[model samples]
Target: MKSLLLAVCLILALHCGEAAVTCETVAEDLYPCISYVAQGGSVPDTCCTGIRTLNSQAQTTEDRQSICRCIKSAMGGAPLDSINNALSLPAKCGVNLPFNPSPSTNCDSIN
Candidate 1:
């Protein structure tokens, strides 16, 4: 479970942008996710699916930022803020999320 959280965090950080992604970023994202889980909430399936797609598609800053935003939004408003606060990620990570993020969809499907 801990490792899964770590992976999720690392994936989120990496989705922030290649330059911004780091172990610290991973740690940052992890804190809030764990907190949310500890509060008896599960990480939304949409969030996980977003992260996975982001990890698979990440190649540029724009792509990363888009993915970050998608994941944050999937978590809904509060979790989004918590993720940003814990990760110290740029506000861009909060921008332009897709309306739908079904597991079968790709980043291109977001727009």
Candidate 2:
């Protein structure tokens, strides 16, 4: 019983740690680009250049959402509803976004 409890505790701890890491990684990787894009700036060649590399690392919705949050946060009070509205565009326009494209891109394109 004690061993089982220890194992469960370890798993929970690891999962929590992983969640935090995922959020931080997404923010660090995507926030700067999102900020630039939000200002009516073009995605730098470097941004597109790194997309394939970053896509390979994003594997889940939480990871994607973290990046989205980072982008919205960078936008300085951009509403979540507006951001989400923006994110729906690429698919609507047949542009296949990277695994976790900034919601701002979709928002900018459509709204």
Candidate 3:
């Protein structure tokens, strides 16, 4: 049992590391913006920083699609009543996103 658990952990870690950009990574990178995205308020510099970083990091089409899926999933699960504010984050941060991040967005169609 212990060996199986360890193997599972190793496999998960390897999978995450292999992507270098995963759903967890997307969630983490955009975590700082949650408050602003959920509630209408001044977006923190850190949020913009994270957005910019996310933009730069997601260089490939695959990465962008994955990120879009991750973001959509996160937003879908968010407690916020409205995600309209979140939609403006990329533009506010001066970052252009290939796909819109919304609960209704089809992640598979991002590419």
Pick by TM-score: which candidate is best?
Answer: 3
Candidate 3 local lDDT, 23-100, one digit each (tens): 667666776776686566888999898888888888777787777766665455445553677888888888887778
Ranking under lDDT, best-scoring first?
Answer: 3, 1, 2
Candidate lDDT (C-alpha), each: 0.43, 0.42, 0.68
Task: Return the clash pairs for model 3, or none.
Answer: none
* Model 1, span 2-110: residue lDDT tens: 6546555655555453333433443343344454443444454444443443354545555555554545433343344444432432222342323333333454444
lDDT of 2: 0.42
Clashes of each: 0, 2, 0
Q: Which stretches of candidate 2 lie over 4 Å from their true place?
A: 1-21, 60-76, 79-95, 98-111
Best by lDDT: 3
> Which pairs clash in model 1?
none
- Tens-digit lDDT track for model 2 on 1-111? 344334323432333223333434544443334433344334454444344344555455554444444444443344554345335434433446544345344422321
TM-score of 1: 0.33
